[model samples]
Target: MGFADTIPARLGNLSFRISLDMSNNSFHGYLPKEMSHLRQLKLDLSRNLLIGQILSALSNCSRLESLDLSYNQFSGYIPKQGIGNLTMLKKLYHIYLTWNNFSGAILASISNCSKLAAISLGHNKFSGQIPNSIISLCHNKFSGQISNSIGNLRCLAVIDLSANNLTSEFSSSELGLFTSPNRLHIFKNCGLKGNIPDSIGNLSNLVILGLGDNSWTGSIPTTIAEINLSSSFLRGPLAPEMGELKDLESLDLSNNQFSGKILSSIWRLESLDHLSLANNSLQESISDNL
Candidate 1:
């Protein structure tokens, strides 16, 4: 087997205009602090075997627009002086650092990066309440209620906070505040309770909704298209109004307490491709037309 190699410190001497992409490699060792010298617009070192904390010197790369260091073994708290200092890069927009061993509270200073449109920090060990300024954060150790401040992001379109330690009830008022969103996934047992809010109908652009594997009670909201609500405590008859979702493609309601015969209108969904209603009390026989 070939031995792993380290990034050369000499690379820092290269022209500041050179963008570097060293992803999906077997390179192992600490990221050389010398790399901070280059003022590239994009830097990608994801899917590697690198270790150690990110250098605070990276903050010096004033022209950086995109940075990706995901799928590495890098551990320790993200240097406040390192990432937080990037707010000066007025053009910086995207930052991806998922699937690392990063732990600690997400820096509050990140709120200053107002130009940032997307930052994926999922599958890490991050804790504490999510910063209101962030757009996407998932599969971490975060704990606290879904902040109402999230409603202020009127231009926001996508949000996935699944698989965290959030222990709050679903708030209808909070859901109603969002005016623009097409995808929302907050599932995989995040300790959420209460009914699926009727206010969910306010999201006219919503096409994909995943609220499964939580502690949800009450009936499913009838104003959705694609949906997943399996493994919850929801009961009662499947609403016949579900037939109104003519664009529905997938629906999963397994492992619930729903009882009653399957509605005949469900069989007429011309766009339906996937459907799962297993492990429920439904007494309907399969329709011959299906």
Candidate 2:
């Protein structure tokens, strides 16, 4: 661990810099605005004790491609003129600002970064409707319905908005917009309700799905694999067609209101290694064929 103190202002005077990594240090105090003078391609100051608002002057780093300032005590809204100005940098592809005290609405200007592939902004105090451009935003205080505009990001392959205060019913149209073949969708504990859209069957490329700890009301989507819908309002017979998901390895429908005889076809799932149907109105015993 490095000694805690303000970063030296003189270090920013260096020219032709390509990268600077000062992460996992004890550095505290506000980030120096002068550091933006270095035209670096990547800058990482994460895992530090840095505090105070982010300086808008940092936007001067026109060549910066990646910026990571996570795991710090940095608070206040991400300045629209500050970090938002980085949209002009066409090469910027990644931004990591998770585990901070940053609050307020995520700037819509972020959508201008067309080349961006990944961004992590979880574990913060940010609140408000998510920007249509963002793909990953979890563990925040955001409320309101998830905008249908999110479906416009055709290339988005991951969506994690878990642990928020949102109280909106999951929309089928919003769910069907995700056409990405290899996607991981997680919306656990976001206060979501309503039936699980049958349109979910369209996500043929979905690899992992987590929608647990909400108030969902519907039968299990028979086509899904590696699903977790535990602790919800879901009721009805466990779909026998679930046997069609030959690739399913984990299925958890516990703590629900389902009532019916265990389907005999479930024995056909050759790849399933984990199964939980506890706390339901299920009847009958496991077949002796096992």
Candidate 3:
């Protein structure tokens, strides 16, 4: 059997608690209201069988800095009182709520956590545009245009919205907004169109970029390499700048409308171990250089 509803009442007396990790257990029933009395710093109740709405009274845990309630049977919208109202959460750094049945819009109030660095609400039924305060938003059923406000997250390092309904083209300035070192951006199958902005090269620490199965047009940006634009509508000649990615190991541009000759400079990518240009309009000529 899972933990009983009376469990919280037993643990409530320890008001000086800083961390409670009851993850991957059979703890069931609603989260207890008695949790509000403790000044916790971290709470992890993931991978459990717990259900019911997150109690608004939890806002009283003023020293909380990390919360992970992922992989559970929790239902209902996130507390309307807003987790942002917890002033102590201003120091919160991570929030994970993946693989749940939670619904409703991601509140703009989440930005109140000025020190927030990572947030994952993916694999949920969340709707509405991503808030500007978010550093990384991914894999939710979110809709609406990805606003340029995303650029405001100077501390952002990764963003993967791989299976959503976000649309719109990024202008040069918009693409250049991301300055995080070692960033990975994925937007596969998201109905995105328009050419990839050349400003993509501006991401000095980018390692992986996936934009496949979209309606993007235009030539592959010369400044970009080590990317996957396969199964899209990208056309035009391969750019010589393909040689720029010294660390590029894999490049996939197959099933597109690329024409003309392949860039010979691509062969010089020392780190490149896998390359694909299949099903394109390129004229074949035997090349003695392998």
Best by lDDT: 2
Clashes (N, CA, C under 3 Å) per candidate: 0, 1, 0
User: Which pairs, if any, clash in model 3?
Assistant: none
Writing each residue's lDDT as its tens digit, candidate 2 over 1-290 gives: 67677788887887577888889889989887788787766888899999999888777777778899999999999887777755766678888898999999998888777777667899998988887776568999888888776666666777888899878776677676676564776778668899888878788777778889999987666666799999987888888777688889899889998998887777778989899989999998786636
What are the TM-scores, per candidate, against the unseen true structure? Answer: 0.90, 0.91, 0.88
lDDT, candidates in the order shown: 0.79, 0.81, 0.75
Give the distance in Å from residue 55's predicted Cα in candidate 1 to where it truly belongs. Answer: 1.3
RMSD of 2: 2.1
> lDDT tens string, model 1, 130-239?
88755557888888887766666555566778888887776677675565554553445578888878778777778778888888986666666789998878899988
Residue 94 local lDDT, model 3: 79
